[model samples]
Target: MTADDYVEQASEIFVLSDSFIRIRELIDDEASTIDDISEVILLDPALAGTVLKLANSPFFNYPGKIDTISKAVLVLGITEVYNLVIAYFTTEAFKKINANQAYLDDFWIKSIDCALLMKFLGTSLGIVHAERLFILGLLHNLGELVVHQLTLEKHTACESNDINLLPWHKQQDILGFTFGECSAGLLKEWQLPYNIFAAIRDQDIDDLSQYNVETQLLYIAKRVMSKNQVFKGQSLDYSSLVTKEQLELLCLDKNMLENAVDYCDLERLSLLAILNPRASMLY
Candidate 1:
């Protein structure tokens, strides 16, 4: 079956909640105030508490405490808070799926590692609203979940864990399409913005010169995730894993690459627990 077939089959299970839909609508509405967004968020106590926790988390590094949804909206800005909500609700949505617990745990760990790296790299490059890249990095591999859910027989083959062979390459060899392409297809089916789905669609391409900076960042972050063997507990040479040309794509240096790796290593542990779907079950 084609990626679209798989996406169509899994669409019902992978969805944004009505609360997130309302939050998106409010963000798009010109007349909406901080109170407006805050009201929608507070209706779901779990979402409200998570928002406040994220606002106070090291994710933002704000100077003072953010005790309420309204304060979070004012400090993190409506757009950023919207992105955080997307990140939260998206992860939470996966809680209902009946997949292998260990596999899901590893999947989220690698995803968060990629996300923290993307945020750090984007922020270092002085990109605006770099926080949004976290969602991109976090969600880039959701197609793998789709494959695991819909086409269980092919999922293991598609994983292609050999370090020498890149993941997208192995996916294409087995499934005739990369997981990134499948991921992009699923996001587009969800009616996400062009900037988002488009980047994920093309992230597996050999050359990223023609794509946007976010796409380039995804490529770099994925490379780092694979090379560092994140959550695999093996230390690899950072310099050897990332090439000069790859770093130069974003005008970043080796030091910045090392720092990004370090940042992910330091932060991913806490975020792994916070973002895991199981953790959200307590809320």
Candidate 2:
């Protein structure tokens, strides 16, 4: 199917939950208070639980526990709470697709890894609106979900795995374009933000000059997460995933990159344990 076809399909068939829709509206309203947003979040028990977990997680580093959605709001602030809601909300949206639990877990773990790093690098590198990058990193592979839902069974049944085609190209072979392209299209339809959809589309661009720092953050997060996911459940140096050139682009040195790599692992499992408490396979 064409990229347009996938975008149309996702817009029509892949519905965003009501809670997410309200939360999105809440973020846009200059007058929306923490209570207004928290009331909406509390309506969904699942979203509340996840939001509380995130607020309590090292991601926030709140001094005391965040037991209620309202407290989570107070601790995380309006902007941060909104960002966290979008991250979890978008995750639930794609989980409705037909990927099996095993596949979903893998996807979840990888995306979380990328997201954690984006938050880390964006902050350390002094990028404004780092919270937005967290959302970008989490949803970076969304088009992969669309393509996987459409072609996964057949793609797996194919006995030959092309050694030469890059993963994104292999995706293009299966779908009309890469997941990044598909993600941009869907985000555009959702009317989220221009820079977000624009940066999502720029992830695969080879030339750094073509991307602003925000898009570059998205690109590097993907690269590091791809490598880190492969190295999961094994003992290996993921520091190699952070190269000198990638560091230079971020105006960071090797030490910061390595620290971020280490932090990715340290936090990935902790976040996974809380997010996917039932999935023992992550062990």
Candidate 3:
């Protein structure tokens, strides 16, 4: 199957939920009031519940639980609320995929970690639309999700454990396109800003000279997340991929990178606990 084939196939399997579609349309139309937006959110009980749950999650760092939708909006801010809505909507696609739970869990953990790290870096850089950057980090691996789903359908006999053994290009070849490319295409189709599509499309930090601070932060965050020495079976030299000049440009250093990783891990664990409230044994 080609990338276009997966795109065509995904269209059939993944219809954007009505609530998400409505919210996206309203936001695109520039409906400026909280009530107008909140009404659209409240149309789907599941989406609303997810928002409130996420608002109370340790990820938000709220002092106390927030029960109401209006309070969630107030606490998380308008951009964050929109991000949560999209996240809740997009998670259904992952749920429908037959990928291994452990792989999916790790992917989500890493993505969330990247999002937290990007948000931190964006704030430090005084980047506008920090929350949007966070959302981009969270959704950056969406193409992977699509590829995994489509591959499962094509290779039903293939075991999950064998997936990692396939070369990166081979995996993409089998699936018709790499996740990075597909994710960019999908986000573009969704009418997201050009920078977001570009950032997701090009995960390489070296190729990000033209991107703004927000995109640069996301690009670096993805590189950090992808640097799994143990999982990849090779020591990733971040120095080679991310030069000293680039780090200085971003106002980052070894210490800052280390601290960001630590902070991101903590946030990921907190969010995981919220997602799996009963998984105390796992923790």
For all candidates, the clash counts are: 0, 0, 0
The 10-residue segment with the lowest total lDDT in model 3: 155-164
Question: Per-prediction TM-score, please?
Answer: 0.91, 0.85, 0.81
Error of 1 at 259 (Å): 1.3
In candidate 1, how many Å is residue 165 off?
A: 1.9
Candidate 3 lDDT over 178-255, as tens digits, reads 566677777776666677778777664365567677667776787666664213455556673457877887888877
- For each candidate in turn, give its C-alpha RMSD to the true structure in angstroms: 2.8, 3.3, 4.0
Residue pairs in clash, model 3: none
lDDT of each: 0.81, 0.74, 0.69
Name the candidate that leads on TM-score: 1
Off by over 4 Å in 3: 62-65, 152-177, 193-195, 229-237, 275-282
Error of 2 at 126 (Å): 3.2
Candidate 1 C-alpha error for residue 235, in Å? 7.8
Q: List clashing residue pairs in candidate 2.
A: none
Cα misplacement distance, residue 48 of candidate 3 (Å): 1.4
Candidate 3 accuracy as lDDT: 0.69
Candidate 3 residue 149 Cα shift, in angstroms, is: 2.0
Better of 1 and 2 by lDDT: 1
